[model samples]
Target: MKILHTSDWHLGRIFNQQSLLDDQAYILQEIIQQAVNHQVSAVIVAGDIYDRALPPADAVALLDRTLNTLIGEHNIPVIMISGNHDGAQRLGFGSSLLKHSGLHLFTSFDQLLEPVILSEAEGSDLVIWGIPYCDPEHVNQYYKVKTTDHQSAQEHVTQLLHEHIARHYPHSATHVVISHSFIAGASVSDSERSLSIGGAECVSADLFKDFHYTALGHLHQAQHRSYSHVRYSGSPLKYSFSEVNHNKGVSIVSFHADQSCNIEHVPLEPKRNVRIIEGELADLLAQGKKDPNNHDYVQVKLTNKEALLDPMASLREVYPNILDLVKVRNNEGSTNSERSRAQLARSEMDIINDFYHAMNNEHLTDEQRQILQNVLTELNNTDTERSSKRA
Candidate 1:
């Protein structure tokens, strides 16, 4: 049995205040195409199906269309769970009714023992257990078990699943665990929110050892943890500038009749990619003119020490989707803050003169300088008298 694993869709995500519905819609179409091309038995969406708990109308529409095409049109079964960003109750709305259409949503704790059985001519061959993003308090109240942190919560939850499986289906078969979590040792990028402060949120990869394949979410980078079968499919598109180099994709997992598994990564290309470009403003403009995909979202780093008129406005003329602009000075690549620190070392008069010129495009006249000096001397004398009185 073959299943395509993908997650972290983050529908309704806005990057730099621009909507990503078009980009998301484009990638989801490709994913559907891949599903058809690969002929996978089911599609597994680990979690983070929405960018926020309350999503916009268009985002909800996009999700509806995508699911309709996958489940209604193609007759593909989708196993989805809710992530930290999702409102579990909202996402799982109409889930029981939707299951008739082959959409299995596991959003609450009571559904942990339930399994989505992938059957063959003889009987069930694969048993999938989904553990959604849940709080320790909710788990404690549901199972009457105490869990202090995220790791402890996840450990206890998986332990119950193990016991339930052992008791009910002791037969030989391929068991799959689908969850949304931050597994220890998985590389993290800026886009993912820390589940907790310190290291309390991270769960050990050893917890999923008994399963044939563990499809995980939470991390926005496609990778495996501890073993090849345990994996994260990553977000379909780059959500932050830090993810410029991420090779975003989905994992196609195949489960054999013998209970063995094979995992393959199939890349998903976005309509417009996120990237960073560095150079002087003039050179970047020159380069942008020659580039065809200059429309890609970019963060510009200008190497010019000298000031320019509206660098962001200028860059937007060529690369219309510039994410942000940063100014760097000198051969050593000092930042804008470093330049300000250097200005801090200058005399007050010098700093004022520079600020005056920057604002008015003219330096202080000799008469203006003399007037400023007299005012400074008067202020110094007044400060001296006040300090004497205080002493």
Candidate 2:
């Protein structure tokens, strides 16, 4: 039995203030083409179906058309779950009816019990247990179990699933577990939103090793954890520069009677690939002249230290699709991680001072510093009026 696995669609995503809907639509169509090419039994999306809870109207329309083409036109069955980025109830609306059309959306908690059984006349049936993204507190209250963090919550679910299988379908079918989680040791990218605060988000990968195949999501870079059977299909499009080398694709897993599966990674070619290029402004401009794919989503890290006049305009002349123009730290030759760590160790005013120096090659005057400090203090005041917007 074989199935197509993909995840972290993150539809309607915006990167560096640029909307990626067009790129997303193109990649999704490629995934559908792959599904049809392989003639897979089912398509499994691990989660993060939408970029946000209340997605824009266009994103919703894209999803509708994509699903219609996949299920209505091509007659492919799809299995999906909700991620932390989704509004579970909203995503699962009309899901009961959609499942009849072969779209099984597992968003709510109680769905853990009702496995989607892909019955075969040959008896090599597939039993899928979909675990949607849930908060530890909600799992505790719903399951009547005390799970204080993500690890505990997942362990509880794993134990319950084991008991359920033992009581009902022990060794009867090939079990596949699909979950949206930040599993331990999985590589992460800036594109992923934090599932929980204080780094309490990761769960042990050991929990799903016994399953025939476990499909995972949340972390953008697709990879297997602990065992080959447990895998993440990754995102079809690169969502951030942190994932510049992700080799975006979907995995087609062929399951055998021995519970071993062969995975074929069918790469998704995007209309515009995300890329990062670093060099001095003049050198980059010279290189961009010879570069063929200048329309790709590009992030340029300038090695030049001094402030320049109209650098973006100069770069844009060569690379019109440039997204970010980063001013690298003065001659230290730092990696992104090093710069991030250094920023975290700095105070807000110090960070702003660095930016000021980069812009004007001067520090703030005493009076200017005092005024900025007052503004910062006022912003930090708990009594200060604040406006809220959905991120």
Candidate 3:
């Protein structure tokens, strides 16, 4: 059986303070079209259905419509899980009823071992285990395991699932596992929110060695982790300027009776492409004027020697979707260049003051300076307290 693997919809996501709901809606429609064209058995949405825990009304509506189109109209089965960004309780609401409609929303730890058995006419019985985003605290409470970090929690969960599968499922079944996590050795992008601080969130790729195919999420870049079978399908859209080079797409996995799988990436075309253009103001304007994709989202870098007034405003007159602007200094003799060099010798407070002035075009007032000083003092105290505790 063939299945479409996609995740991190982030339906209510905002890019440069601009709403991306319309673009999101368009990409989702493309995904549905891909599913129809491929004639896949089911769709697996790994996690991060919404941009935040409390999504906007329109985001909810778009998700509802997408689900209705897949499960109601197309009669396709969808297996989805909640990521760290999703409110598990909220996403899991009506999950029991929704499962009857071929929409399996797995969020709770109670459903970890349960398998969504997909029977195929030409392939072996496909057994899928959906593992949602498991916090360290949740794992400790539910599994009675002392997992202090994400790695331990994931290891414990996967071990339990493996043992359960060994005892219950037949050897001939094609096993597939769906999870949202940061596996060790996977490439990460700026768009993905850190699952945990201080690098304790990474789980070993060895945990998924037993499964025939592991569909992962959380990391925005689609990549394999230490093995071909363990992979991340990546987000369907580029959520950050850092991901401007990413070829956003979905993974189509086809499984055979021999427990072998083949995966293909189907590129998704966005309504507006994300691009970066660099040149002087005049050159950039000329290029923008000739470019057919002026409607595309852009980040411009100005390399002009002379200071331009309202450069962003001027650029927007031609490329209306310019999201970011930066002034690049070509020569090292500029005043801004000297300021950058002098900042290395300046004190932290002085540097902060300079930064404040640069950003707001005004010096920090006495009151604001005092507030910053107090904040720094509190942070230092907290650090000392942590150090004492560690000692």
When sorted by lDDT, best at the front, the candidate numbers are: 3, 1, 2
Off by over 4 Å in 2: 305-307, 333-391
State each model's CA lDDT, in order.
0.88, 0.88, 0.89
Q: Count the backbone clashes (under 3 Å) in each candidate.
A: 0, 0, 0
Candidate 3: residue 349 lDDT (0-100): 70
Candidate 3's residue-wise lDDT over 181-266, tens digit each? 99987888878899889989999999998899998989898889788989999999999888888889999999987899999999
Rank the candidate models, highest TM-score first. Answer: 1, 3, 2
78: Cα error in model 2, Å:
0.7
Q: What TM-scores do the predictions have?
A: 0.86, 0.83, 0.85
TM-score, candidate number 2: 0.83
Please identify which of the two predictions, 2 or 3, would achieve the higher lDDT against the true structure.
3
Residue pairs in clash, model 1: none
Which candidate tops TM-score?
A: 1
Best by lDDT: 3
